[model samples]
Target: MHRIRLLTLILCAALAATLLTSVTARADAHPRETGRTVSGPGTPRAEVGLDPATGTPTLAVTRQGRTVLEPSPLGIVTERADLSTGLTLTGRTDREINEHYTTAAGKDRTRSVRMHEARFRFRSTATGARLDLTVRVSRDGVAYRYTLPATSGNVLGETSAFTLPGDAAAWLGAYRKDNENLFNGYGATAAPTGEYMMQGLFRTGSGDGADYALIAESDLSGSYAAAHLTHTAGSPTYGIKLWDGTPIQTSGTGTLTTPWRAVITGDLATVTQSTFTDDLAPASRVRDTSWIKPGKALWTWLAGGRAAGQSLEMQKGYVDYAAARHWPYTVVDAGWYFDPAQWDVTDPDWQQNSWIPELVRYGRERGVGIHVWIHHRDLDTPEEREQWLPTLEKWGVKGVKIDFMDSESQATFQWYDQILAATAAHHLLVNFHGSTIPKGLQRTWPQVMSFEGVNGEEKKTNTPQHLATLPFTRNVLGSMDFTPGAFHKPDRPNAGSDAGELGLTVLYESGIQNLSGKPGSYDARPVARTFLEQLPNAWDETRLLAGAPGESAVEARRSGSRWFIGGTYAGAARTAAVPLTIGHGTWLVETVTDTPAGLVRTPHVVRGGATLSVDVVANGGFAAVACRWYAGRTDC
Candidate 1:
């Protein structure tokens, strides 16, 4: 028996040595140190390199034989359990990505995109576990993500640096814990250090035909925290840091693909025109999306709920106004259940909120939908969801605008998905306010009407600069219930001229256009009312005729046969050569331009192929449109 045991132990020891040797030899056989280039196949091409020699990988795009990525050392860094130091390349794959998608509701309904992609497989030198870095380059810009080979451990964090050359100008929107917070437009070097909101825009400079780009993440299935830009004061470094949060995740599957770290590239036109998010994100998860509706909604929050925005009579005033304007929805913003004067749902009087059902019934009687606002934390449990959602649906509530999520963890994502599922199951449309950036999730759940992730009129501080920055940033991902159509003059000083506000109505996109400002205030304003009459729920096409982010902006949008063009400028007044695309023929034209007296409309005539020259003043805007039909022709 002793002899047999000794032989078995010796045999086991030999087997262990052979396994270790095999792993070491396999890792060594592959090139441990590699230098390879992943170049773009599309216009304004971006080429990046992946090297295993330096575990600190740099993201450099070869442009004009010069590395577009300013500093050569900016690259990817990561953390995990076995591979605490991230990955080192041990293998490679080069390929092309050609994808097309269509959304029932979005900035544009359909998107098609292609990218040159390269996958560099790496094995941790410390642990034989493997990972892959995929770099996808297209006209929109560059994107990369780490592909983890199934793990049962938590990812501590990532410190990937993304820097720009010559210290490019940038608009850093620090993490938006709420709306009304503005982005800081600083010289690249002076950019505020730390985290940034999703879809942040950065430009080269105030030069002739200078280029700009935006950074954001796509396909967040929630295995990791959202990524944000991080830098230090007076530093030339730019990189990404995971939005640190609690509930360190500890679960996964066969393979975990992190969200795409994407950078949108090109001129303001190109950036605005880019559909990177919609095109590449996972296809819609909702199979039957025919019930999804995108339209304007009236809310009492900005109207200052309860203070002046309270009372059943006042609430019906909103419903009456919505019905009058043919708006689809009228929202009883937070405080309807209780008092806006204070925040607490536990009050016994809260249940006495008979006004909500009555209001919903009134809205229904007037052919309007009723959408209410609520907090995310309030409905965290399945029982709570089971109770509240069904009750709201029974109360004739058409939709909900859930708020104050303030989280980007995996658990939050699961809950979000659950909410969407339950809401859709209830046949209710949803508007996500105080939420994270749209990951093209609306494509998955078309019932998610709009996302209020921008610094809209909610907390004020809005300006022409901020509004212009949006078309290229936040709006790029999806609709922004920028709720922008604020035609009231008093609000214009902080936001823009009445006409600029009108322009915003066209510039911004949303599944629900939640217009701010009291309707009574603008009741005497004919021009403002006329602009509202023409507001469109969905756009057939979008054209960036002229302008850049902060300097100015001009856009031409189409809804069916009618066409609308809007222009706004910042700093010094500027001229924009706006193009027309409403087919060929003479047509009646109307112009709403910012005048000292106020927004005024002038009638004129214009034809297809003619450029509508608009001279806009600082913080001023102009909107003009030509009816699709001619005097004698009926076909528009």
Candidate 2:
């Protein structure tokens, strides 16, 4: 009986092996690659080595020499290593470590190996320790990795830190306003020590820079170190930071650990990528309201500037334009409320304001919703917040834009969470300006529509160089309120007039897209107008077409049957051929939007397995359409 059972098991194992082989072959036949490859479960393979002597892991990248990312045993140690690609360090001291690599394939294909070291560490007399990670990037030598020393309390202490070289600063200067320090005049200045600390920096040209900062903090006691590319000037833009998932104890009250991971790729095309995790202790805290649907998009004023009663006619015209175009919402910008100094949410002035009632009425009449702007500092007190809620609800406001968060204390962070929750209680959507980088709160609070944490069009005067850097840098954190859609040229006052502005509709991801150009601008360029009208702020699917760091990028997005493709160049002009392969259904018709020549409507016949090749000019791009099968149509 035992021999018979063994034979049966062997036969079954052979059958299973054959089935697995067949499935693997089928999957291999239809392999698909999307976006740029990174170190993940599916990453390619490469040879990695760890020095038993020094306990540092070294990666022998093909093009780049043996690159040592972190120290051996990869714990908390600061020493020099080969700084080839850059440095890699673990967030905490006691966390687990992992490594990944992509195998070399064809020519021109770049492969990389990544080592992730994580652990927990404790400081003297400090019941808990915050995670700190430092990764140094260099061109020649091996990258160095070290754990940043955590301070005992809130006060920041000066410690030896690395600063970007002068040449690097000069290289980054071209992207700044007036070639000054990027963070100069923004409330916080770069320390001579050159260590990047959590402090304010002017985002070059956004007028008010007092509210922005670069923050470094740890989420877990010794689990994750987070560097926030933050802003407080009415709106903020987040840079990149690395995060290793771990858990730690909270020091005091009103504190919850949330880990944010970001990467700022100076390379223009693949600029930034980020991930966020909520490190909340299971059932140990106050009411948590982090589960919210996230929506992002741009906005524009339909009425005149925010002064009292400038011209309702202008407001009406703007509202008319939005309605005619079927836009999602129109914003009542800063000037709508009474004087900032005298304004009080409970004051009769709030109740008597004609802007909200009139605009809401007009917007509702036209099927467009209204989002009103408010000053963040004023809402600091609970009384102010309480008064504003009922008023906004009574006014039928769909959303509120909160600006000027301006601080990085634990208190302020808590307040931000409060505002998000408070507004959600009223069913009012929220857009945060002068804020910190998104820590994936949108996933927790769906009503928290969008946030302006980027150096957007407001900095057009600085340089067009920032445009190329943003996609891979600032965009990774979360939805950005870049406020795109200004059709006017640079000559227009305060407009960052890049031809690529049109492409931003496709490049930047937002649920609430604020169309900023004047009505006349869109009217003059009907092709651009049609493009805007056709765009859906929400998308069902998004695809990164083709790109290299700091070069150019092509992207395709799908909303139902309609498809939109946008391509942008960093500095130089380039061309690309993008193939449309979004779905299986055939398109019945096609429409192309091209500038100067206006919208060109064309019809193409496509089948299930056919691909449409498109060519785009330099500093220019193409938007094509493919309608799904409806009724009797066969071509798209």
Cα RMSD, each candidate? 8.2, 12.6
Which ten contiguous residues of candidate 2 have the minimum total lDDT?
Answer: 101-110
Off by over 4 Å in 2: 1-68, 71-298, 301-304, 307-310, 339-350, 491-499, 571-574, 579-618, 627-636
- What TM-score would candidate 2 get against the native? 0.61
TM-score versus the correct structure, for each prediction = 0.85, 0.61
Cα deviation of 129, candidate 2, in Å: 8.5
Judged by TM-score, which candidate is best?
1
lDDT of each: 0.70, 0.45
Give one digit per residue, the lDDT tens place, for model 1 in 149-212: 6662556655456677666788778775543356667777777666677666777745654677
Sequence-dependent TM-score of model 1? 0.85
lDDT tens digits, residue span 400-469, model 2:
8888875444456668767766887877877777766454455455565566766665553433445544
Model 1 residue runs over 4 Å out of place are: 1-35, 39-48, 51-53, 62-67, 71-88, 94-96, 205-209, 245-248, 307-310, 339-353, 489-496, 572-588, 607-609, 615-617, 629-636
